[model samples]
Target: MAEFFDNYGALLAQGTIDTLVMTIASCIFAYVIGLPLGIWFAVTAPGGLKPNTAVNTVLGWIINIGRSIPFIILLVAIIPFTRLVVGTSLGVPGAVVPLTVAAAPFVARIVEQSLAEVDKDLIEAAHSFGSSNAQIVVKVLLKESLPSLVRGAAITFVNLFGYSAMAGTVGAGGLGDIAIRYGYQRFQGDVMLAAVILCVVLVQVFQSLGDWLARSIDKR
Candidate 1:
């Protein structure tokens, strides 16, 4: 292990940073797009207070199609668009484009599920108070669902971390690429093992953080 660190410590460190960069940036962008989208889906779905079948169906289809494609294929499939967005398709910036795109729909679904778990009675109560649609959505739907949303955000963050590693397969520059190129291709088991450990650590850190935040903020 000392020998491995001496030889590849800097490489591993850089790879870890790149992975975090891709994961965090992608998650932020994805959630920014996904939150409103999920709210739109929830509010417009059949049985929703302001149901719109046409709008809900179109958005659902689009989100499903986006989610159904495998991330690896999505990576390659959107190369041109990635380049268009980031001006290159082989580093952190390039990876961010695909990562954000791939994660947004997934994040949307997560947000939708979290919102779905909100109490219908609370929504109705807010309605009885003469709250506007926007007021009920913000104060009741979103405020009540905050804990679930935080947990979902953490899940999305870590899941995107793994996907960012896969982006390394395309030279996106993370531990996954490092592990593949040096560990698998060159038969350096120690390097691969180290990368895998770092990934596990990341997962644990996010999981714990998410749980703590949810517990701290939850009123009931």
Candidate 2:
């Protein structure tokens, strides 16, 4: 046990840190793009506040196309773009670009779904009170969907966590990189096992925290 720790502990610790950093950074950027797009989706759908079939259909197709691509393929396909964005596709910053690109469409779908679940009555009441479209979106739809959004964030984090691992294939640096270089290539079963365990622990911890937060914030 002590020998194992002595040999791989530091490496594992660094890998864990890198994984967390990549996942978190990707999640934030994905949200920055996805949140507004999602609101647009909900607001312009057929029955929404400002329904526009043309805009909604076009946006839907675009997001669908983005979501259809596999993460590994997206990782390689966007190498040039990723490098352009972050100056190199080789570490946490590199991994973040593809992760965000891959996750943003997904995050947008989640947000649209959450907002769709908002009470129609509330929206109508807000309208009767002469609230602007922007006010209703900010105060009613978003506020009411806060809990669901938190849960969606957890799901997005977990998905990005997996994608970050795949980014390790291109030297993006994370537990997945360590597992591939040492555990798989070097035939170190114990190292692979340790890395897998840590990933599982992280997923469980974050998912639980997200659920708790969602429950705490839910008013309805």
Candidate 3:
């Protein structure tokens, strides 16, 4: 074990960093696109704040189709678009394109669920106060649903972390890539074990932080 660490410690360290970068980048991108999309989804649903069934239905279908595609297939299938967006289909930046695309639908779904969980009474009160639809969503629904949204974000982040690892199969340059290249391809069990341990540690740290944030935000 000591010998193994001595041999591939640097590589594992690099892989860990790559994995972190990919996960963080993807999470940010996913939220940037997904949050508004989710808000739109909620507001446009039948009898919602804005209630545009046609727009809601179309957007819902798009989100569903995107979500239905398996990540691996999505990764491979989107290669052309990925390259068009990032000019390459490998490494951290290249990986971000597919990661964000894959993550957005999942994040949107979570956001929609969180927003839906906001009390109907609160929305009604905001409306009674002559609040605009946008104002109510921004001030009431979002503020009230923040804790749940944070929890949902935590779940989405962890899911993206797993996807980032899977992206390594396409040379995305993360711990997953390291595991595949050195662990599986080169038959290095130590390297694979190290990568797996690193991933587990990352997930634990995120989970702990997320729980802390959720608890801190809980006024009740």
Candidate 4:
């Protein structure tokens, strides 16, 4: 055990940094793109406040196509785009491009679903008080749906965490890369074990924090 730690401790630390960078960066991009798209989706669906079938259909199809592609294929297929965005398709930064693309649709879907869960009565009440569509959405739908949105964000974050590790397969430089190179290729069981344990711990921490935040925000 001591020998194992001595050999791979530095690599493990680096892996943690890589994983954190990839996950956080991708989540930020996902939220920036996804939240607006989700709001649009919610507001344009059938019977929605702005109900535009054509726009919603096209946007939904695009998001669905993006979500359907497996992450591994996405990583390889978007190499050119990734390179154009980050100048390389194999480091933590480069990995963010694909990870964000892959995560956006998921985040949008989650956000839309959370918004959909908002009580229709609340929206009606806002409308009855002469609130504009934008006001109703901003003050009624989003505010009431905050807790669910937080939970969705938590789920997205965890999913992105796993994807970041997988991105290491293409030299994205995370715990996954470390495990693949030193553990699998070099037959270092200790390295693999440590990486897996670290991932588990990270997920647990995220889950706990998410639950706490969601509960705190859930005034209803």
**lDDT of each candidate versus the true structure:** 0.90, 0.93, 0.88, 0.90
Better candidate number, 1 or 2, judged by lDDT? 2
lDDT of 3 at 103: 89
Candidate 3 per-residue lDDT over residues 1-220, each given as its tens digit: 7887788888888888888898999999999999999999988877678889789999899899989999999988999999999899987888899999998988888898888888888899998999998899889979998988989888988998888888776776788888788778999787888888888999999988998898899785
TM-score of candidate 1 to 2 decimals: 0.97
What range of 10 consecutive residues in model 3 has the weakest lDDT sum?
165-174
Task: Say which prediction, candidate 1 or candidate 4, comes out ahead on lDDT.
Answer: 4
Distance from true position, residue 139, model 4, in Å?
A: 1.0
Off by over 4 Å in 2: none
TM-score of candidate 3 to 2 decimals: 0.95
lDDT of 1 by residue, 25-144 (tens): 999999998999999999898877699999999999989998999999999989999889888888889889889999999988888888888889998889888999999889988999
Q: How many steric overlaps are in each model, in order?
A: 0, 0, 0, 0
Q: Which of the two candidates, 1 or 3, achieves a greater lDDT against the reference?
A: 1
Model 2: per-residue lDDT, tens digit, 8-94? 999999999999999999999999999999999999998899999999999999899999999999999999999899999887888
Query: Over the full model, what C-alpha lDDT does candidate 2 score relative to the true structure?
Result: 0.93
List ranges where model 3 is wrong by over 4 Å.
none
